[model samples]
Structures are given as structure tokens and as C-alpha cells.
Target: METTKRGKVPLYLWMLLGFAAGLGGGLYVNLTGQVVIPEVMEIIRSVGQIFLRLLFMLVLPLLFSALAVGVAEMGDLKSLGRVGYKTLLFTVMVSAIAVGIGLGMVNVFRPGDGVDPLLAQQLLAQGAEGASAIVGSAPQSIEAGQFFLDMIPSNVVTAASENQILPVMVFALIFGIGMVMAKSRATDQLQETLQGVFEVMMKLINLVIKLAPIAIAALMFNLAAVFGWDLLVRLGAYALVAVGAMAIHMFIVYPLLVWIFGGMNPLKFAAGVKEPFVVAFSTASSNATLPIAIKAAEENLKLPKRISRFVLTVGATANQNGTALFEGVTVLFLAQFFGIELSVGQQLIVMLVCILGGIGTAGVPAGSLPVIALILVMVGVPAEGIGLILGVDRFLDMCRTTLNVTGDLVAATVVSRGETDAVVPVDEPLPAVAPPD
Candidate 1:
């Protein structure tokens, strides 16, 4: 019931309170060995589910509208080409580096060796039925050429309905390109409408974000009430390794990029990004935090509106450095847990899959789980091993999402720096205004 000057609790405080209460409640339940009624737990979980669903509902519309407008706003073919190439190249290279770091950390730490086999087996058994259902529906194998082909949806409506993000992205990109090429009055009008829709979607996101504190509290409480401390103890090393890799990427890698490529002070870059980072960490959704990230880049970071719009919007959908890193660490941890000794080639394939999966991953909570499960199966590791990390994933999701948004902002800054036309002068006025208008 604590309220800030605005008469509502600040979001960060709300999330912190939720997390603390959940942790306390969970520990109490575990120590006392009291059974929470299943029905009551279900109600709590339902609140969290509703929150997740609300966020998911916005993903497609937000992606399409933002991407389309961002792309169309690029104006001409040549400018679009230059910006697109730099943005994507930077995104892919950074994401690949993140995966490399994850692979290296997991290999060195070998968190799987610390996990008790009996505990792993028990965890596997407990979630076997759900895991089986996941594997039963998973693709038998992923083909390289087919992956590209599948991205071109036969029916975009079907893709949106089923939440096939990659295909939807492909559709948006093509639609945006067409709009740019047409260069007609109607096309301009449509682009304006899409931009308006993008703004509306952001407003809706702000509305839904108000529910986050209670929803996150319910989620954490449910997780604690159901799983307890034993699982955390067992997977502590694996969790540490995953989190540590993300930390390295965030604290070390990103700053280095800002200082080196962006020619900006790393400390200043970090300071500028604080607002978006908090929203991203608390919500665990890059798409949900897109509007704030854009605002930060333009206002605090002084990135050009053109570059920030294109890079950050596309990055929200495709450049998932943190998710890529987590998937790499996760796949390796599960492989080690099951005594699956992957060859060098297999490890490289795992790296590739994770990088690609990160690009396609939706910017929502636990969005990487299904992709992780699929990679596990492709590597002949038990898809059921997903059960091992599910308990700790929500917390890790928060960490990785922070990295994801940070990486996007870094890409925007670095890429903007490279474009002479796109770099706003450091001494430029914050809100440029005509003096005599």
C-alpha cells in the first residue's frame, strides 16, 4: 500500500516488494512443509497467466506496426539498404559473440558435473508427461534451407494466429519494403496509419504494465510455493553459470562496444540506458519495453531518431543476444547432465541453432523455452531435460531480457555512430525548436 508522490507505488518498488514477499512466502512454506491447496495455487498462477497473455496479445501488432513504420520511414532504397546492412551485421556479430561467451563459460564451469544425477532423474520424472507432449509435437529435424523457406508464410493471418513470430517478421519486412517502393500517396497514408497504430500499441503496453507488480508477485509466489528450495540448490551452479555469462555480456562486452565502436563513454552509455533497463528487467519483455528504449536512445543517448527507430525496432524482434547466450549455456548444461558428450561439430551446431533461435525469439517471458527444448531434441539430448531448468528460468528470464534490451541500445548507438548522417551532434539541443516560430 506504499505510494510514491504519484499516488501509486513506483514500478521498481512494486517489483522488488513482489519478489521479496514471494521469496519469504516460499521459504516459509518450504520450511513448514505445509501443503498449499492446489485450487488456491491455480488461482495465483492464473493471474500470472493472464498477465503473460495480455503481453502476448500485443506482440504481433506491436512488431508489425513498429517494424513496418520503422522500415517505411527509411524513405529511399539506398538509405534503407545502408542502414539495414549495418544494423543486421552488427546484430548478428554481437549475438554470435554472446553465444560464444556462453559456450565458453558453460564448457569451463561444467555446471552439469555439479548436478546430482538422482536429482536430475527425479526432476525428469516429475515433468515427464509434459515433456513428452512437447517432444511429440516438435519437429524431427531442422533443415537449413527449409528454415528460410518456412519463414515465408503462406498465410500471414495463420502465422499471426499461431504466433509464428519469424514468419510474421518476414511478412512485415516484405510489406514494409513494398510500402517504401510504392512511394505513392496511398502508401504514405498507410504508413502514417501504421505509425499511429504503433503509438496506440505502446499506450496499451503502458496500461498493461500497471498490472505487472501484482502479476509478477503472483508468478513468483506460485513458483516458490510449487518448487521450493531443493530445486534451486540442485541447479545452483547451472543458474550461476547462465547468469554469469549474461553479466559478462552486459557489464563487459556491451560497454567495450560502446567505448570502442560508438566512441562514447561507457559510463555515460550505462547511465543513459538505466530507465529502459529497469522496465525490461521487471517486465522480462523486450517488445514491452520498446517505447521506453526508443525514448532513451533519442533523448538521453542523443541517437538519431532515424537510426534508433530502425535499429531498436528491428533489434527488439531479431537481435536477442542475451537469449542466445542463455540457450547456449542451457543446451550444454542439459547435455552434460545427461552424460551426452557432444563432438566439436555438435557444439558448433548448438551455437548456430541458439543464435538463429535468438533472432526469432519473441520478446516475452519464457519465450525461449520451446526453442531450447527443440535444440535439446536435435542434439539427441532428452527434451525432457527442459524440466531441469524450468523452475529457475523465470528469474533468469529477467536477467537475460535486461541484456537483450541493452544490446539493442548498444547496436543503435554503435551503428548510429558509423553513419555520418545519422549521428546527432553531442551539443545539439535536446528538443530542437525553431526560435521565432
Candidate 2:
């Protein structure tokens, strides 16, 4: 529940300081060809690993509690009624498109490729020792039949033990659906318990994130020291691709959905949702921006309150097209960076997980990091490569958060289409209610 700002010094200012120090130090070593002290570099690497291990330690519990609670909270689809189904359908379809756009952009541009060959080899060599176990255990090639079959998991505990993330996720989802069906006092308690677990995990993750400034310094220094200016170029390319993919989804995809499905003019929709867009970008937290989005839907867009509330509220958490797209792009970019080749089936697996991840990922700053890290490990990419992106993530976070909020409003507007309820009148005075004695 803590804002990104903590105490007198904001978390972002600290993060920026860490980024600057690391970048400066790394560039010095790179340009001068002076070797960093071995002991100091080792300490830096250890610090980075500590951070990653902390995240790795909590990944399963976090994933389970978040995904399960998220699904259960949706309530029974039958109970959710017509609007629920429509919102769910729109969320899935639109999130898929967003991921598709990101994957396509990465594959076509291959930004992860075109790095200096020697630099790529050095990165591979550095990561190979730590990554060997994961890389070795990964399937030599993904087969369509086996891939689908393995999703069920012969034993959920065993799947979690082996880091078979997809199977674990499947189990969590089924578990959630089971809670939804039971619908008793015990089930309600179970839901609350899971919700409690999720809140705790979010707190723990945020605490870990507090160390991110140090972690970012270590991570950026490592990359910059070795890769030199090429690191910046590749990082720039990645940020560009991420922003571009999001832009496509926001400007092109959302508008098309609003026009075709919602029967609203695209230009009008864009103008009406501008306030929410700015709020989302500035805050980079969907949950924080929810009130603004609701207001925009009701006031500027003149959407029905009932539909807008339901869709926008759920969309704030469940309908994160932007997060899903970013996850896909980061995974592929890292895979490419590490010289790992994921086949078509594997990429499809990434896309599927991303769609699920979008639903489960916390609506907070840097929330997508845990999911992206796990996906990289799931597919044999080195997890440490996440460091390369963290320094630049705030900007990307802002960009995608805007997309997330905009997507929510668009869903609200689209879902409101043809509802018999009258739109809220702009500038209408509130009806006075008598105070209770």
C-alpha cells in the first residue's frame, strides 16, 4: 500500500542515482579498457544475485496466491452475468493482440540481435555457469502434443519443485475456479486467506524492490562494464520497440475495438480518455489511477455507471494488455541477448503465459518484473539479464501504465455500448442525502 515515494527521499530518486552511478562507472571501465578490481566486481555480482534469489524464492507462492485469488475474485461467470462475459472476452482477445504485436515487433526487428558478436559471446560465457542447470533441463525442442499434455501436471507439488511454471499456473487457476464453484463459508475463508497471502507477497516484493537502487547499480555496472556503448544501443533499441508496440496497441488496436465493438467514434474516444491516460502515465500504478479512469468514463465518455464501474474496476486488475505485451517483449529480448533460440512453439508458450500473467501481475510499479524473470527461466534464458532492463524500466513503466489505463476506459466504453441505462449527465449536481441521526 506504500506509494513509490517513501519518507523524505522518493524511491525513484534513489533508483535514478543508482542508475547514474552504475552507468558512469561502467562507461569509465569500458572506454578506458581498465579492468575493475576483481573483489569489488565479485561483490557487485553477489549483490545482484542476492536480489534475484530473493525474487526467485518467493516466485511460486506469489504466483499461486496472486493467480488463484485473481481468478476466484472474478466470481462465477454465470453470476457475473452478460457484462462479465463480455468484459472477459474483450480482455482475453485484446491482451492476446497486444502480446502478438510485441512478439511480432521483437521478431521482426530482432533488436536483441545485431549486437557485437564478441560481446554476445562474453555475455553467454558469463551467464553459462549459473544458467547451465536451467538451460540443460529445458526441453531440447518443444513438441505441440507434449507441451499441451504437460500443462496438466502429474503432481502439482512436483511441478513446483521442478520449476515447471506453466503447470503450476494451471494448478493455481484450477484451484481458483474450484473455490469459485464451492461458494461456502469455508470457501470464502479460503478466498480471504489467499487474498491475505497475496497482500503479504506484494509487501515482501515491494520491500525487495526497495533494494532495487543498489541492485540496479550492480546490474547496470556489470552490463556496461562488459558491453560498453553497445549496451546502451541495445537497451535503447529495446525501449523503442517496447514503446512502439504499446503505441500500436493503444492508438491502433484500442481505437479499432472502440469503433467496431463499442460503436463509438475513435477520435471521440481518444479525446474523452485523455485525462485517464495522463494519470496512468504519471502514476504508473493502475490501482492508483482507477478513480480517475472511472470519472473519465462517466463524465467525458458519458458511459453508464453500472457498466463502467464493473469493467473499469476489473480492468484495473485483470485487463492489462500493456503488461502482457511488455512481458513478451522483455522475454524475447533477453532470450536473444543470451543467444538462446526459442522455437515457434516456445514463443507461443511465452505468449500464452503472458496472457495469464497479465491477469495475475500486480498493478504496481515494476510489477511485471517477477513474471518476466520467471518466464525467462521457464524458457532457459538467463534471469540476470533482467538487470539490463531495470535501469530503463521506469520510463517503460510509465508508457505501459498509460496503455493499461487507456485500455480500461476503452473496455468501459465498449462494454457500455447498447446498455439501456442512461449515461451520467456531465456536470450534474449530486442528489442530497439526509444525514442519519
Candidate 3:
């Protein structure tokens, strides 16, 4: 979890203050028909843009390093045997379901729609330069065959330069897989270096996020200034949909998986995970809650240490069902907000990226921001539109993070099922290993 370093006020509180202030200012301009000074407005927009550009600058390095290290950390899958294969499969399936739920909810609710077309056009105009560049760069029509072919970047550097996110991610996954296959002192050193890179990127992201309150205030002021009270209505609807989707996945999908596959009663499973769930929600960070989660799995849930440790540790980074869901909904919602209609093929592409992104996204507060930003650009949505959702993100972050942590436990339980030695009684001492002879 990100602590409120250097300030007494919690970051979330600061962010909410920024949101309230910006919303009030925007509402004043809208209700009173007061004209905002052109220069002042320009300055506000510039602040938001600078913050956004910083995020864009970090996307490739953060994505590549975080993803490669996450994969390599899984170690040799062959050695892991059934536990490894099952966990990997479970991660993918659950993530796919998560993204499916998010996309489905957005499609049904269409909260991003129903905005005034004139206001939508105005929003586009404000972000015209960057939006135009993104739109111009994306292929006019994304065909199925060509899209699959494009996943393998002909030149990784060129793909990265062009912000071809899918190709770049594919390269990182393959590179990480190669590292896993060829384990040696050299590979170990490389993994350590990549881990170091990921840690540095995370720290950099934390620093950048300190500016979020100011940036969000500016972004919201710009948005509310133009869109008026209607912006508030749309934002409320978007939040409702996001929270609603997460609720269903949390209460419904996860429980069902636990009941059927893990042979654990829903009540028992819920009772066992309460500690981790509370810690996860309060901290809003999977990384921060990992130790508690591991403890809950072994002592509370009575899961075998080996399965619990491996699954929860890997799941901390690579099994982010909640992040995947949030990214999917956010992307599709933005596309709808900007009046861009994505084809079925395009939506599927979004799904795939969200699933892959779930695995690669960092397990910290605001970790999903860069991934969401890049996805918006990929789908021809104005990345600037992200500001529209920043106000509500802290609350949503907490909610989705709860789901992420709980999902890890669920994965552990299901993976542990059918193993002959699934649990070691909490009261019983484990067999000791002899010292190296």
C-alpha cells in the first residue's frame, strides 16, 4: 500500500478534496454561466496534460519490466508440476470471467452514453491534438487475422515506439518464458535486475501519483466546466456500474468457484478469508496485504503451506482479476463517452489486453492507471477522458483491490483441492528438514 508520505492528510482524502473543489468550481461556471479566463483554463489543462504525459512516459518501461519479472518469478513451471499448471489456468479463466463481467455491464448500462453530443464534441476538441494523433496512428480497421498477426512485433523497439501495447506485452511474456526455461546463475542475475527495474518503476509511479490530487482537480475542472452538471450525473452512473460489476464478481463468481471446485462451503470460505479481505480493503493494495493473505490461507483456511505460498505470492502480481475487470469497463466506458463505437472484434481485443494486463499490472494503489491510459489510446478514445473517472477512483480502487486479494485466496483454495496433502493442521508441527550435510 502507498503510505501518505510527507503529509499528514491521507492521499485519498486529499484526492476527494481536489474532486470536491473542482466539481464546485465547474458547477459554478456551468450554473452561473461565468466565463473562465482563457489563460487560466489553459494553465489548468496544461497541468493535467503534464501529469498525463508523465504516466505515458513510464508505460512501456513499467509494463515491460513488471510483466517480465512477474512471469519469471513463477519459476520453472515443469518443476511446479500440477500446482503450477492449475494456478496458471485458474488465473486466466478467472481473469477472462472478470473482464467479461465488466464489459458486459458497461455494454448493458451504457453509462458513458446519453451525454449531450455537443458536449462530447467539445471534449474531443479540447483534447484534439493528442486524440487526433492516437486515432491517426491506430489502424483504420482492425481485422481479425491482421490483429492476431500484429501481436508478434516484427521489431520490438518499433512496436514500443508506436505504442503497440499488445505486441510489446507479447514480447515481454515470451522473454520472461525464456528466462524461466533457461535457469542459471546468469538468468538468476537477470531476474534480479528485472525485479529491481520493476521496483524502481513502482517507486516512480508512487512519486507521480502524489501529483494526482492536483492533476485530478485540474482535469475535473476542465471537464465539469465544459460538460456542466451533466458530467456529475454521468460520473455517478459510471461509478455505480463499476462497483456493481465488481460486487457481482465478488459475491457471485468467486463464491461459485470456491463452492464447486474447492469443495469448500461458501460460508466457510468467506469466514476464513475475512481477515485478508479486511486488510485488503483497508489498505487497497494486494502487495501490502500479502502476508496477511498467506497467513489466512494457512492458519485460517487450513490450506497447505506450499500451495498457499506459491499461489498467493504469484497471484499478488499475476492474477489480478479485479484490475482486469476495471480496465475493461473503463476502456469501454471511455470509448462510449467519446461516441466511439468499437466493433465486436475491437471489444475482444480489449478483453485480451485486459486479461494480459491483469497479470502484469502492479499490485499497488493506482497501479492500474498506466494500463488504463494506454488501453484508451489503443482503442482511439481520448486518453484525456480518463480525468473524468479520476475523482471516484480511490473508492473504486479500494473495492476492486478487495476483490483482487480475495481472488488470490480463491485461486489458492481451488488449486489445493484434490491434492492428497492439501492441509497441515494448524496445531500440528511440520516435519523438519535436516541441515545441509
Candidate 4:
């Protein structure tokens, strides 16, 4: 009971903290000339980078255990197909909506094109790196020839063991559906062992979550120290519009989605996810928070255990409306910044690519950027635009993570309710027990 009260940190307190620190620190750096210290900046960057790397390291093991357990426990072939179809369809449609929001925002606000030409050139020139990592750039090097075929995993064990979510999902999914075909005795036994192990791993990850505040504080500070406060204001109008659109999507649109589809009170659901919001804000990784979000839906909403389990595990990979939103907005912003007039064909590409990209994004840190770089190339946006955003990506990441996890929760809730139950398919039906021997 007491725990709930502590969760409500007054909004003004946080605003003040952000304001005072940003205002004071900006003045100090500009006054003392200490912002450019080579050694100090390096240490700051190293700390944040280390934390970011550690957060990503948790993805494979977490997914493996969660997906394996989620699928094995149910062993329900019928529900598996139904659930998978709903998840994929929802992800695609919502992702397109997110792209539309981005298009609307950048077009209205025109954040990028407003930058002075010289600053635009210099921003492009700064210690910029491509947004993508090696593994994330599928649109370019992946070759459009075999996109669908590549999604089907040839080797189940290799895929899961390697943490390839698309293939791992394919494998775990088929194995669960097949295993459910076995007699009840076998499925029951398999589920018992997997659940036991998964619980233990979850506890360990919780400890890692405790480390997140420290990591995030260091990360935010480090970023502020190097970029200087001016970076936040570089394209102030553009950032505001993007952030504002994300806010409307998260607070207004997502909640409305929940009410319309799930018939649940949006305020209660939001209140329930407060802890997740904080974690999502700090850690900025939906893949990392899958376990927590599932637990919240199960515990707070009293959702059927299996319902939260399967829906959320799958949602972590497939449902990413917030990410779709970010990718769309960022792409358009870059086009505007470079004064590149996007033809109708180019805008269409952004819309389609972002929708797919949001779905394809792995549930890990910095996972979306590489894919963004690939999309830039597809639409003829200079790839170097990626490096331009890296400086602020760390900060923007916090906001995006909140939306991603929140959207998953909303999707899970809605999915648990079938047409009979208001179309929320987020909860699980009680497991059937074996007949008396």
C-alpha cells in the first residue's frame, strides 16, 4: 500500500530538477570553459556507453527465457495463430499511423529546413556516426529479393541461441504449437520446468534494473556535458514538435485506443504502469522491460496469466508504434534539414519503410538507428544525417522507450479481450486441468 504513494513523484519536482541543472550547468560550461576537457568528456562517455551496452546485453537471455516459457506453457496451437495474427496486423496498421503522424508534424512545423545552412553543414560534419549498427541495416544490404524468406528461420536452436527474435519467434512459435499436440502430460511437465527457470532469471534481471537509475543518471549527465545545453535548442522548434506529437500519441491517442477497444479506464492503466514509465524513461529499452510490463498487466489488471505472458512477449518484438512514430519523424526532419524536397514517391517510401522498420526493430538499445540509416539510403536521404542525430539520440531515447512499452501494454490489454469480451485479447483464459485419473 505504502509503495504506491511513493511512486508519485510530484511533476514539478522533476521539472525543477531538469531546469535548474540544465540552466546552471549550461552557464557554468560556457563561463568556465571546462566543457571541452578531453579526459573528463571521455570518462563521461565511457560510463554511459558501458551502461548502454549492459542494458542491451540483457535482451537475448530475457527473450529466450520469456518467449520459450510463454510459448511452452500455453502449448495452445489455436491461440498461437490467433494471437500472432492479431499482433502482426495491429503492429502494421498502427505503425502506418505513426508514420502519418510524423509526416503531419514535420510538414506543419518544418523543423529541419529552418536551420541555418552553415550550422546544418557543421552538424552533419560533427563527430557524427551512422545511426545503424552492422546487424540492423537489412533494407540496404539485405537485398529486397529475399525479405520474406529470410524471416523464416531454417534452424530453430541456432536462432534462439543467437537471440535472433524474428527467427527465434518463428522457432519457439512452431515448437510450442507442435508440442501442444502432445498429450497433456508431456506439455504440463515441459511447462513446469521452463517456468521455474524463467522465474529465477527474472529475479536476476530485476537486480539489473536496480542498476538502471545509476546508469541513466550517468548517461544523461554525460550527454549534457559534451553536447552542451545549446544542442537541445539547436532546432528547438523541431524538437518540440516531434516531442509534442509523441506526447499526444502516448497520452491521448494510446489511451483512447485502450478505451475504445479494451473498454478499460485509461487513467487506471496509466497509473498502473507508472513504474514502467520511470524505467522506460531512464533505461530506454522496451525489450528490457518486457518482463516488468507483463508482470504489471498480470498483477495490476489481474489479467489471465497466460494472456499477459504470450501477448507481451510477442508485442515486445512485433508491436512498436512509438518506434514507428520516431522513425517517421526523424526521416522527414532530415529531409527538411538538407533542403531535399521529398517527392510523393519519397514520402511514400518513408511511410512504408517506417511501418516495416518499426515492426522489424529488435527489442534492444540503439537497434532502430541502423535500420533508419538503411531507410535514408532507400529514399535518397544522405546517410550522414544519421550521425547528425546521434548526439541527441541518447536523450530522445528515454521518451521513445516510454511510448514503446506503453503501446505494448495497451495492445496486450486490447488483444486479451476477444470480440465477446470487447476485443481486448490481452488476458489469458484460465488453464484447463487434466481429468481425474
**Highest TM-score among the candidates is held by which one?**
3
Off by more than 4 A, model 1: 1-79, 115-230, 420-437
Model 2 ranges off by over 4 Å: 1-7, 77-79, 132-140, 420-437
Global lDDT of each candidate:
0.72, 0.82, 0.85, 0.60
TM-score, per-candidate, Cα-based: 0.60, 0.91, 0.93, 0.57
Ranking by TM-score: 3, 2, 1, 4
Error of 4 at 211 (Å): 23
Q: Tell me how far the alpha carbon of residue 247 in candidate 3 is from the true structure, in angstroms, after superposition.
A: 1.4
lDDT of 1 by residue, 89-204 (tens): 68668989999999999889888774456644554453344344333322334466775677689999987776665567668777877887787889889988987786777667
Give lDDT tens digits, candidate 3, residues 359-410.
Answer: 7777656878888887877767777888788888888888989999999999
Residue pairs with colliding backbones in model 2 are none
Please give the TM-score that candidate 3 achieves against the real structure.
0.93
Clashes of 1: 0
**Which sections of candidate 3 miss by over 4 Å?**
132-136, 420-437
How many clashes show up in model 4? 14
- What tens-digit string does per-residue lDDT give for candidate 2 at 1-437? 22553456767778878988888898999999997788998899788778877877777788888778777765445444577767767887899999999999999998888667787678667665655544234443566588888789999998888877788888988898798778788988998998888888888888898988898898888888878888888889999999999999988998899999999999998898888888788878899899988998888889988788888887888888999999999999988876778899889889988988888786645768778877887787777788888878888888888888898888888878888464445689777999999
Minimum summed lDDT over a 10-residue window in model 1 is located at 130-139
* Residue 347 C-alpha lDDT in model 2: 95
Q: How do the residues 384-422 of candidate 4 rate in per-residue lDDT, one tens digit apiece?
A: 444345445556677877888888888777777763223
